[model samples]
Target chain A: MEHLLPLAAALPLVAAALLPAVAWRRPDAAWGWAVAVGAGLLGIVGLLLRRLLQDGPFSYAVGGWAPPWGIELRFDALSAFSLGIALVGVAVLVFSGRYAQAAVPPQRRAWYYSLLLVNLGGLVGFACAADLFNLFVCMELVSVSSYALVAAGGGRIAALAAFKYLVAGAVSSLLVLFAVGILHALTGSLNMADVALRLADVEARGPVLLALGALTAGFMVKAALFPLHLWLPDAHASAPSPVSAVLSALVVKLGVLGLARVLPLFAGLDWLVLAPLHEGLAWLGAIAIVAGALAALLQEDLKLMLAYSTVSNIGYIVLGLGLATPLAMTGGLVHVFYHALIKATLFLAAGAIIHQAGFRTLRDLRGVGRAMPWTGVALSLGVLAIVGLPPTAGFLGKWYLLLGALEAGRPGFAVALLAGALLIFVYYLRILNAFYFRAPLREQILAVREAPLSMLLPVMALALLCLLGGLFGSGPVALAALAAARLAGGG
Target chain B: MRRLLTALALAIVGAVMLAGLAGLPRPGDPAAPVHTHVAAHIVAHGVEDTGSRNLVTAVLLAYRAYDTFGEVVVIFAALAAVMVVLAPAAAPPPGKTAPPPSPAPAVAPSPVVGFVIRLLAPFIAAFAALVLWHGEALPGGGFQAGVILGALLVLLSVVMGRGLEQPLVPAAAARWLQAAGPLAFAAAMLIGLAGAGAVLGLPAEPAWGRHAVLLLLELGIGLGGAAIILGLYLQMRGH
Candidate 1:
């Protein structure tokens, strides 16, 4: 069980390789194998979490090389938590294979699953990696796989969206590489921990600050920070449902995690140099919160509206980080986990509704609640969570964040948080009203039925988790508090 | 459209040439106050720390191995993406027989061009091998060698036509090989873990283990690089 950490990363990769071979011979075996692999991943993640909590951080050295020389995998509390979110997301997505098969042709289905698994493996690996280079490799793996996955459905628009994503991703990679190079040149190391140790003094230098700036900017773009979020809506909305769920849920969070990791590395730099940057990030977060909610409100297409909502939710996480207090950082980290689960649930439910009902627009979905009660119920719960209603995980994150903002004496940010919550309520209420109160669009309603149990099972499980997470928020809060302290150089 | 593509290609090439020329630093001339210290640090510790005879490989594989790893993954990812996005469309129904392969239009290649390609193939292959084998002691490494091999394949494809090229390396095999590169590196890293109790672990007998690991990792890199380049080339050709 202890030795399983490496296999958690390896299994999906190996399964990815084996998928094409299986599809080549037995096409039916592809989905079965993908499901099995997803199940295996969940099992592995469960085991890893047990080990992580019981035995502290787990480290695996690749190629028998020690730190500062060999690549390393570290499963600390933070990483394990993130990996849990990603693997659980993959598990839920596995249930969507039937829909994917029906929507995409048999020939493309294998490739889609292959890309999906590879992307999943990449995200998991990125979370666990201790080496800077390994993180970069994993980041690219997720990025490149996601681009292909986004375009796999084969439309001219999908292709164009993919191309844009590729260009943006490429630019981000270049920036990251440039930052890594400069850091390596400065510290003579590629190990994140080693670099941190060596860079304690050197981070005050102009070039080091420049490198940090580039890295932060690159990660900010990847996270779809408000002003830089231009590519996100098109990429998410145009992609197939499963792909959209993964993109909104997991891929963007990688950028947020990268920012968190790099922030601590620049600890001792003059606050004046960082002050403007922090303020800028906070301002962007506020704007993104308002803008995303407004944009979502205006969107007629169901998926695009959800996509914009993701951009908005991400703003809260970033805002928590920018506050830079211990409580705020913990809130930010907790949001990463809570948001991944909640957002994935919401997106999956939305996908299920779209697939069954063919409701592309909000107006088209009139009184869908009466037809598909389970999906509607799950969606309503997800929306309630997103709106920061009490006893929901979303509320806990916001509560912590609002408290942190108040603690940091940022009353303005607290106001933004309050406004954002109200906006979420309004939009979600609009969705609820359309689903439950309005008259049914008869033709669309007739086509709708309860989503497949496989799909509903994952959605319901996650929806229930939104409640569980809020009820038992202390466990994650404790872990996050520890990680935040470590990140702030106190631990 | 052809003219526009040609113009765009030429502009990109021209810009690259200008950057290359403009960015070249003068030999032994310290450009900045910081360069003096950096130069001294490199001179003092570079050779001793990195076992590679070639300073570039030492810098690439040893000093900055992480960047190289990232680069390798990036290329692999690009290839995987291309494969996923452009997988062959569904086969026609059973009752509908597929159309026959298009007849090759014989446009005569220039005799001089054919001669150059034929003459260059073996030497290019040899040079690529040399670069790969002597990477630790030369200006070139796996990436450069892989590119060279890919360039040779391109030359062969251009001279011999697509049919012959397909036989040399089939699409399926190319995809497998591309995947094999990173997997191979990962395998080598895993092996390192077994020997030294960690991935990317250099054994206590650094000379033997490091050399073996480097060679194995490079082989993966070469295969991956060649396959990805070929895959992209084929995708562009609408294969």
Candidate 2:
């Protein structure tokens, strides 16, 4: 199972490379192949996760070369996020079967699934990477695949959005690569653990600060934290729904996770005061929460609203990290997992409605709930979860965040968090009202049927997970706390 | 005012970056960590450990093969991206055609130019092969050879006026060729596991084993890179 660490990331990529060839004669076969690969990935992740639970954590040095000389892949508590990635990956792939048949052209379908697999492979690799250069490489794989996935559905607006995303992604990737290079120069090792050890002896505070600053900024942009989030809404909203789910649920978290990974690198440096950075992050996160929800409230398009909600949710995670309390960081990490499930549920359910009814806006999709009850119930569960309603996955993270804010004696931030939640609730209320209460503004919505089992199954499973994530929240919360302890250097 | 603000932001960022870079060790300083740490190790043991005369190839394919594998996938993804964005809508019925978005060169290639390219083609191919074959012992390697071959193909296509409508390689074979980089890496990974007991580990016993693995990677990367470049060219040409 420990040996499976590298295979977990490699299998998806190898399968992806073979997909177009295998499906060349019959493009329809691409869907089955992608789902099977995705399921295989899930199975591998399950084995790794079980191993992680039993043994604590494990590392694999590729090519039998030891760390600092060879690339190291670590499956630690922090990397437990691979479970979420694989889960969402399989769901999204299963969901894409029906969605792509409608949304993507037959000729482009194989490439579409191929890119998604590459994106998933990259995300898993990024989570497990312990080497600085390896992290950057996996990040590039994810970024390139994501930019293309945005334009995969193919339209002028999507092309334009993809270009915007490309510019932002390219700049961020360069920043990360630049920092990696600097770290290598400073420490003479590309391994993160080795660099952290060596960084303490380095005399150049300027370069150290610069590297830290560059990494934070780059990852923040990738995570789409506010102010740096200009490219996210257009890109996420315009992408094909499955791509949107992957980007919103898993890809953006890369930045937050990247921050978590690199923060500990500079933790041992005495001259570097992370307090100022934390303070700034907390303030910005507070602003993003209010601003993102307000922005979501104004959007008529369902996908657009979901995209903005992602920005707001990212704020909650960042705020939790910024608070720098064990509880807070734990909350943030837990949200990272839960948000992936909840957002994926929302996007896929919303995707089903839009695909079936041909209506994307709230007003256009009015009374869609009655027409598609299961998907509507799933979307509602997702909506309730996202709003931080009680006993839902969303609530636990926010509750922890609120307690963390108070625990840190920052009532002002606590107020901001509560206020943001209220704003989210009000906006989500509008969705519920529109979805369940209003008369059908578009008659075709009445004729729309329940989403097919392929799409419905993934959405329902995710929605159920969103609920289970809350009810059985202790497991993930414990896992997150373990990760948080390590990030805080307590372990 | 907006332009001035933009310039101000750019200048500030540039100044900060420059300041940070200023703190780095002086270039080519032998005592710097970059030289003293991993580089020193590679310099000392690279040849014996990896059995490549050229240290760079040793580093790329042996010590840090995973990163190289990642890079190969990145290139593959680039081609996938291009095709996803630019591929024509579901295959047109046989014998039906949409006019090319951009017209072919208005004038034909000069006879002399074509003749010169035709004369140079075989020599270029031979040179590419040499570069690839000798890469383990020299500075030239897979990526460089790939660029050379890809450029030659692009040049021939230009002189021949072969639009994507009639690709130099058939579409079916082209897909596999474009995927050759990752496919080769996958094969190497399994071979490494069987012979070397690790994924991507090169076997040591048969003096020729490591060389065979290296050559396989070189061919895959070289061919795959060239195929992808041509595919990109043909796609962007908008037939």
lDDT of 2 by residue, B117-145 (tens): 98999999899989988899998888888
Interface RMSD of each: 6.3, 1.1
TM-score of chain B only, all predictions? 0.71, 0.94
True contacts kept of 1: 0.33
lDDT of 2: 0.92
| Per-residue C-alpha lDDT of model 2 across residues A107-141, encoded as one tens digit per residue | 78999999999999999999999999999999999
Please provide, for model 1 over B1-239, each residue's C-alpha lDDT reduced to its tens digit, 9 standing for 90 to 100: 99999999989855643443343233345642234443345456656654556766655554444345546655765665776677555654778643334345367678899899899889999998888888877677688888998888876776766642353587456656766665765675566567656444445565676667667666777767876687677555544
Q: Which stretches of candidate 1 lie over 4 Å from their true place?
A: A1-10, A58-61, A70-72, A203-205, A270-273, B1-71, B88-123, B136-141, B163-167, B203-210
TM-score for each of the candidates: 0.86, 0.98
Question: Can you give the lDDT of residue A174 in candidate 1?
Answer: 81
Error of 2 at B87 (Å): 1.1
RMSD of 2: 1.5
